[model samples]
Target: MATEGIEAVFLTTHNWGKAAKFFQALGYELDFETDHNSGQLRNGDGPYVFISEIPEDQETQTQIVLKVPDADAFRADSPVEVVTPFEDTHYGTKEMTVRDPDGRLWNLQAPGKN
Candidate 1:
């Protein structure tokens, strides 16, 4: 199955406030925020960005989210190496992890089953 392209970008930051302000300065508007120091932002019609705060001791990372119309179909037909099977997320999506030839981890997101 072919991916529907990038759905969003997931970013990890040590300082939520600073990261938010930085994105805001870049013309991204806040979409929603959670009490746990995380939020989504967007610029125009492009893919949204989801930022989460992590402990200062941990290294921050950025991940690109690929959109899939159906996880089960993709899993059954795609040749991508699946690192983790699709699982329902707290934010209400089904997500799976895959590894590229370079060993980079990529996340695939699909709408949760009704």
Candidate 2:
């Protein structure tokens, strides 16, 4: 069988590790871990929570990752100007990032791309 898509829901927090711990306490299993200042936990029914650490001086963050069928074309088709092109993630995904007018970040990912 072919691999299915994956979603990385960006959950903002002062401390991503702590945020992950909180969710883990609630039964979310650690689907993957990373040292790229981000990590993921899975509730098993929906997208995995991807916690990204933010700067102390920066405002809070709100973001989510959509598993696109074709990240490359999506980058080309998105109405919003593509801010970041497809890049390999440390945890394991090829992704592109886009920011809305409100500064909401969206990650378009093609998992297991390596």
Candidate 3:
């Protein structure tokens, strides 16, 4: 199956407060926040924006979430390196993570799996 579209943009930031403010100023409604360290924001439609604090000793990076029809099939046919195998998330979706040649992370998600 092919990717339906972008589901979300996961951002790793040094300052979660600053990042949250930035997205909020852009009219992204706050969906939820966790321990003041991470949050999910969305406009009206389309993909969401997820901001989180960078892990210690890890360089900040951005991740894109792609909505797919089937996470398992996508992983099986994908040519990229699989960083994480298909699994169910607490948020009710099946997801798999892959890394590009440049080491960029891409999360593939399929709805109603979990």
TM-score of 2: 0.63
Each candidate's clash count: 0, 0, 0
Give the per-residue lDDT digits (tens) of candidate 2, residues 44-104: 7887787878877878776667786654455345467567888887657787777778877
- What CA root-mean-square deviation does each model show from the true structure? 1.1, 4.6, 2.5
**Candidate 2 — which residues are off by over 4 angstroms?**
1-6, 34-38, 75-80, 99-105
lDDT of 3 by residue, 34-99 (tens): 985999999999899999898668899887899988765663655778888888887788888888
Alpha-carbon lDDT of model 3: 0.85
Q: lDDT per model, in order? A: 0.93, 0.71, 0.85
Q: Select the stronger candidate by TM-score from 1 and 2.
A: 1
Spell out the clash pairs found in candidate 2.
Answer: none
Model 1, position 23: C-alpha lDDT score: 96
TM-score of each: 0.94, 0.63, 0.79
By lDDT, who's the top model here?
A: 1
- On lDDT, who's better, 1 or 2? 1
Off by more than 4 A, model 3: 55-57, 72-83, 99-104, 112-114
